[model samples]
Target: MGCCTGRCTLIFLCTLQLLTSLERQIFDFLGYQWAPILGNFLHIIIIILGLFGTIQYRSKYIVVYSIWTALWVAWNVFIICFYLEVGGLSKDTDYMTFNISMHRSWWREHGPGCVRREVPPPTTRGLEDHAYISVTGCMVEFQYLEVMHSSLQILLALVGFVYACYVISVFTEEEDSFDFIGGLDSYTYHHSPQKTSHVQLKPVYLSK
Candidate 1:
């Protein structure tokens, strides 16, 4: 399959980031959680700026976007490190497994209580149990997926920062070469010997 255009890819990623940031901001606000409030707000702003810069293709805005993205990479590193230090990977795995088991056990105990009265107990029992297991499995899968998504975002941001730097280098090189060529032309024109059009008239003498 052919790869998507860079502009399209950037727009897609920025849209995802914008949605993620907005969701986090809303959740935190509803929960009365202020610790990450500023961070989420800043992320929203930066993502919007990046989206605008990508669409506009302006060098100044793109340069700012690149710098912000680099900072975002650093922030992700800090977040990952904090998570690791607070709860190691093994601990996180165990926590997710624990949650899955708890959900499964809860469903096993309470599933019958929530079943519809019209459905026969025997026929619905097996189906209900299977549904609970499927739900638990999905929960476990999504827990790991979140972690993978965060890592992938960090990698993408780093790649974007590098690409922006390369673009800046290409622009800088072109400008420098143009100036160098112009300087050489100017120097050659100014320093080269100038031709004089004045010719000495010599008096013609009659040859003997």
Candidate 2:
């Protein structure tokens, strides 16, 4: 297969996916976002499997990887919706953590150029005093950061899905073509098949 639409391109894409997924996993871990963490874990595993398949020219593994890419695209879309508050999904909620904790995105507190301030809360009748954190000077909002991450993931998954399908088709064609021929390379059958069955030939090419 050619490099542009072949296993080489798929391998490069999968490697890039692995790196980005690992980076996202680290931030998700810091934020204690259970859902994204789990998804990233699975994505990493499948990407490695896809990389192995690409290297070894295994069509079945590529097929599984291709299917996973489609599902991955959907997963990222859900994440984008969740972060953007589309379809009634709220970013302020702990939906990403599966309601296990109140911990929010790390970027909410430590985003680029963001400044966090703590101030006393309003007095409540017979209630304990509390302090609230105020974030300002953020170059970009946290929800947008999350959305961007998901968007990037979606883009990579779509590209990978396309390359994976092409690679699988190429693999299939190679298999079919090999079977159509007798699997012969540079050697010709000058003698009977039984006589040339052994690999202990004098030499593939004669000296004189």
For model 2, name the residue pairs that clash. Answer: none
Off by over 4 Å in 1: 1-5, 86-149, 166-208
Query: Candidate 2 residues 64-125, lDDT tens each?
Result: 99999999999999988888889998888988899989999989999999999997777654
In the range 1-208, model 1's lDDT, one tens digit per residue, is 1112555566677787777667656644553334345666786787788778667654566678688887777766655554444545432332322333322112222232233223243346554543322222232333233344457658767766765665555545666898999999998887653422122344568999
| Local distance difference test, each candidate | 0.56, 0.89
Error of 2 at 61 (Å): 0.8
Best by lDDT: 2
Clashing pairs for model 1 are none
